[model samples]
Target chain A: MSEGPGAKVYVFDAYGTLFDVHSAVARHRETIGPSADRLSELWRTKQLEYSWVRSLAGRYRDFWSLTEDALDFAAAKIGGIAPEARATLLDAYRALDAYPEIREVLGELKAQGASIAILSNGSPAMLDAGVSAAGIGDLLDDVLSVDELEVFKTDPRTYALVTRRFGVTAEDVSFQSSNRWDIAGAKAFGFRCAWINRAGAPDEYAELTPDRTLCDLRGLLDASE
Target chain B: MSEGPGAKVYVFDAYGTLFDVHSAVARHRETIGPSADRLSELWRTKQLEYSWVRSLAGRYRDFWSLTEDALDFAAAKIGGIAPEARATLLDAYRALDAYPEIREVLGELKAQGASIAILSNGSPAMLDAGVSAAGIGDLLDDVLSVDELEVFKTDPRTYALVTRRFGVTAEDVSFQSSNRWDIAGAKAFGFRCAWINRAGAPDEYAELTPDRTLCDLRGLLDASE
Candidate 1:
């Protein structure tokens, strides 16, 4: 309830929250015609693998590089990745389509005059590409990364960065992520977290239950005030 | 390798590392009935979910309780879990077979005069049951848990505990797991990690590459020297 206009800040999780990322892989199913869903699953799994690996190796790269690396690796599986398709894959990332309600939700949150920022595992470049592609860059105060934390999402330190960056108690911030684990991470770190279970991921962990569950960002925004 | 004789510890990851865990659900495939390994997949997915959720909610139970919760949840999916079957489902855990080489490899590791231990995400009871059931309890010097770490395996602290307890740097310890991400995590935290890729997880993560890959623990011990 303290999250009204005067609330310290409202931290938003990117990836699953503001973006239709599952559609990225699902799109490959439609676009590739042969590999279809296989490509999508490979891309998603490899993408997560890259981010996690890069974080562990102390080799910080923008998420753009990681995604391309993942796509290339996955492409190597069914058949060799065509040089052309790799470029298309990168383009697909920057051109990621926002969920139907994301733009409206961002606009509404902005109109409310609340401080809004993004806490994402995506590298700055990737975040830039996603927001630019979605046309919601102006709505974000800034995009943050676990790169700063030297780890990936679901690390409490990654969540700590949000409140520490804002100089407020975790209660002063409301974190949102479509990934249940990320939501668990934020809640475990004591943030008032909202889980946007767009895919209806079954409950996995305990204690860090989402203070609120929403079908999408618009649902989050609707329920926030 | 700063770990002296007393300092060096071989921390075995439980689920896929030492114990043939899928057999737990694989045994239930008749009741859950194999949609071609659906039960194993569901059990694993739920176990992970329960672990993360319990950690978040601060309702900390040992991994055994969570395992039962996950089994019941997954069992409910294909059909109702009967009380008798629930007992059987859990009994499967206490009597899981070891990976073919686990017995030989663990015996070799211990015979080589290395301090051995289990670092697992399981509740204390589950870890105990798995180790005793696998018939390798005597081979392990100690068992570690997120119960003490207050975080799950992927957290750096989870790895940190073993190093600190054994008084070794992450550089000296050789951590192993069947889970690709857990290996990725140990490597991320700067531990020497081996992927016991029983299910054949590919090296898709370009950054978090394993220092070594082996078909089984025997290969791990063979490669160690």
Candidate 2:
């Protein structure tokens, strides 16, 4: 809550925050069995871990490649996953389901004349496919990716994309994400931030506190008030 | 394996590579019950996670504060920890036991005219305390901490401390760590890298492979030969 106020533009992270990344694994519960939930957790954990590590190391790889690499690690950890099932899961990731309340929340903000866009670690193609699948691409004014900068979110450079795109200072933009790390990153980069703590998880980043924290994106629009 | 060969100076990560981070919990196993091992694993995981997130977010808390913060997270997850036991664990961490072969391996490297140093995320006080307690403080020519740069390892600035201290290029240093993420960072920073796979863990960094992968520090002295 260190920042001054809300912002003119509203930027958000794509995966997990807007889209249900685990929905891909949930769709194949029949073949995956009891380990399905664990697989999903492992996949998502490795995905973010790889991104952070890669970003810190200055070794840039496309998000899709990292996605496949994470899947391989998860599959190996949760016992051997069949190639066919793996392929299906990978395909499903390209079109992850949007969270139930995203459209309503985005629509409310847009009506208030706030600029809306996705600033994500997702590549151009991945973010495009996700927005298209969710049928909410039209709701967003822009879809920005870190691929242009050859880095990932949490890097100040990646957060700079939002300001660079619309010619706004970080204070003029409110960044939102379900990931605690992303919220910390945005807040540290000088943006007003809202942490969507979907699961009511405890805050892990002890140093950086978000401007606002809510149980869902539904609270985000109300926070601007 | 991307580098040409071994390096002039041998730099290492302190926590898991040279010191047994789990020794704190191992000392309290009787009190901790079956959850002792799980607590250790969770503590170590959260400790590293907090450091990475904090570094990427640019919040810059020292490693000691991050360690205590991570311990709080681990304690909350594993029900709760008693204050007396917590005090004991924290004290044990200051003097965590070094690996059995550390002295022998370090001696062999020192005999061959290698420059020995530790470049760790630990604070100056923490690294000095650990090194003194382990009785090998004299074996190292330098003890570098990220506190100088106010950042964590894997940040190129932290790595630059080694080069700046020795007036050598990254190619002149061979960095070793039990943490795969650390290895990726050193390698990406252009140092010849050695991954001490102490636990036989799978390689998580799919993008950059280490120049040398050893079961322990035993293979390292010979690898340079």
Candidate 3:
């Protein structure tokens, strides 16, 4: 059975799902130089790796720290990423260019009376920087961070924080996360999550499949009606 | 103080360290046909992803089951891979043709009379498949699995299990794990670890630098003796 329409709150996962971190790097490819794509891939791989390892070791550091550290590691290996590029690159994350159709999709959803929020794993400062840079603040109701929870998205407490902040029943909230793991966690926690298959990948965990899977927010909101 | 050369057992992680499972698809490129690289990459990526995701979510499935499931998931998206090809692709993993220099290196280590063992995250059944196929059962002193501990490696208990089984103190052993996190966890548990930098990659976690880092087993065993 489909989750009822009362789940009107559209919570978007900020990275990869809404903001194309890849595009952010692509825009600065000239500055990132020959290792641009490699740098981006390495940074992304490192970014995720740090989170899981740190979490496992019970060594907690916020996402921004992890992101910058990962970039620095990638930079040292492939020379020519200037200090200025760091600011521009780091600054670019907050203002990351949305997928070409994102704004329009959000507009359509809001027009139909849905609340959109950014519930990201990004640190507060980092999330603010990206959301402001991309001009997504106007469309989002709240930019929730996992910083306070001292945990990452899959942790039950991480999603519970969002539920408490929004005052919505877990199942009545339309949680969207780009990561299959996040989607799995939300589904397991009773949230009506929409897995944004941006990479066109399937969730491997059969026990925790999302209620709905979509290509993007457009499909998510459109499906509700 | 250096770890004395007295009774220093080298517990080598079997899968990525000595064996390369990537060939599971690469060798069967003919059967994989088109999109061979992509299919192989997805299979490998999903296998690792499933391990980490399943580990974090407190959902435990043996590496064997997860490996097959990941292949099935990837195959489904890659033009519906034939069952026969899937079987052949997996058969390659049975032996995982060791790296070109692995056998000679193992021979050299044996020549030096170093204590050798296979410590892996694979269950007993899975470990037996790979070990017997490669005919390395005679080369290794003891084949250790996380099964006895009922926990995967990178867990402190996993490292302890190996050390405890060998009846040697953690310092009396040099742990070898190609995985950055595995090295980190092994080091955290106070095992002197030699990270095989097979990828020549930078350290994933800056905090967990190995006691000894080397290009491969030859360098590791040679440097110690």
Candidate 4:
């Protein structure tokens, strides 16, 4: 086994990081017509918005429920979706396509004696289905969900789950996320953070900076060396 | 003086509820081209998103800074904005137009011997600017902001400011907001919430229902009687 980097555990965020959140809507692009992309964008945006709103309101709803609520809102905004189509989209979400590099990257990290896991806002069942469908289940050491704590990400308690689960301090883990806000939260919580900027999004959260800003997960392997 | 309803205090949310948040972009519509409406929508969406994210992360930046950051994000998305135009937009935000009915509604409520105050996510300075610009400063009994607590709205503590300031319970105050999420939060916190559904948007936060859903601020006067 290759020597691991300073980080004993590499915790990844699931949606957008490993799984393509838009893949579900993309699969239904034919039926959704020209508004498919807009629908997907709105769906994801509202999904995260609801999570943060509920988290701040101290009202905990599972990610799946939030996902449904967001989908409904998106559908309404895009002029209504059929109930059957909505169901199909939600089903597609459970088995979203994993980013092409995810399997190979996770394999490389696992072979290097690194403990890989997912810390996501997805419900436990949702994460399980995603991992199983993506066929990355065996490669991960653990799959942690916010459902365990009854709060969403960016919450310190949500990040603390990693430390508690691995019996490691925040510094011992490298938290990776595709979201700038997630990276900001992880860095603020004292975790070594790697921001996967696949879309080259503009910088935000002026006060916090990630340990590494990578184009994709393949860079995680290079960071180890 | 008109007799009050079950609620003792009329607590208004300054942005959107009283002030026209989109008026800033509407003012710059000619310069912004056809993307003006999109930019305004994005700016407002990101502004609230940043607040919720920051609040969940337990990192509090004042609302003005968040507003600027949000505007920058919106500008970037709409294919870059001129620094001068960006400045103009930000300046416009400080003195956003108050809704047409605000003066009359607040006056009607205040004249009826109801305690009228603002409970908003805006910073004290921002709220002061908005209230002053709207020329309704004399009608308010008090203006409360999350800046004092260093957290944004939807936080129980943020909502608690109303109770503590007025020496009243949640049920004794009628909290009003144009944002459905804000209404959900205020209602969840046990306040008598009036959702100012100006756009007649679809319902959200399925579990919590507001005490009143009004098309405009004029309805507040009717609800009081």
TM-score of each: 0.79, 0.90, 0.84, 0.96
Q: lDDT per prediction?
A: 0.71, 0.85, 0.76, 0.90
What lDDT tens digits, residue by residue, belong to model 2 across residues B22-89? 99999999987778887898788778776777667677788888788877777777877887878888
TM-score of chain A of each: 0.86, 0.94, 0.87, 0.96
Give the residue spans of candidate 3 off by over 4 A: A1-9, A31-39, A72-87, A100-116, A138-141, A164-169, B1-6, B33-35, B73-82, B100-115, B147-153, B167-169
Please name the candidate that would achieve the greatest DockQ relative to the true structure: 4
CAPRI tier for the interface of model 1: incorrect
lDDT comparing candidate 1 with the true structure? 0.71
Q: Which of candidates 2 and 4 is the stronger one according to DockQ?
A: 4
> Among these predicted structures, which one has the highest lDDT?
4
Per-residue alpha-carbon lDDT of model 1 for B1-225, expressed as tens digits? 344655446778988778777786677767755552655666776676555444433445677776776776566655555678778868888778777777788777788778788898876877777777778877887888778766565657778878777777788788888887788778878888788887664465556778888887777666654
The true-versus-predicted C-alpha distance at residue B3 of model 3, in Å, is 15
Interface RMSD of each: 5.4, 1.7, 2.8, 1.0
- For lDDT, candidate 1 versus 3, the one ahead is 3
Give the residue spans of candidate 1 off by over 4 A: A1-10, A31-35, A45-62, A69-83, A160-169, A220-224, B1-11, B34-36, B45-61, B65-87, B108-116, B144-146, B154-176, B185-194, B204-211, B220-224
Model 2 ranges off by over 4 Å? A1-7, A221-224, B1-7, B33-35, B222-224
Indicate which candidate wins on TM-score: 4
Report candidate 1's interface RMSD in Å. 5.4
lDDT of each residue in A1-225, candidate 4, tens digit only? 232345478899999999999999999999898999999999999999889989988898999999999999999988998789999999999999999999999998888778999999999899999999999988999899989788898899999998888888898888999999899889889999999999988877878889899999999988763
Residue A15 accuracy (lDDT) in model 1 = 76
After the best TM-score superposition of candidate 3, give how far the Cα of residue B64 lies from its true spot, in angstroms.
1.5
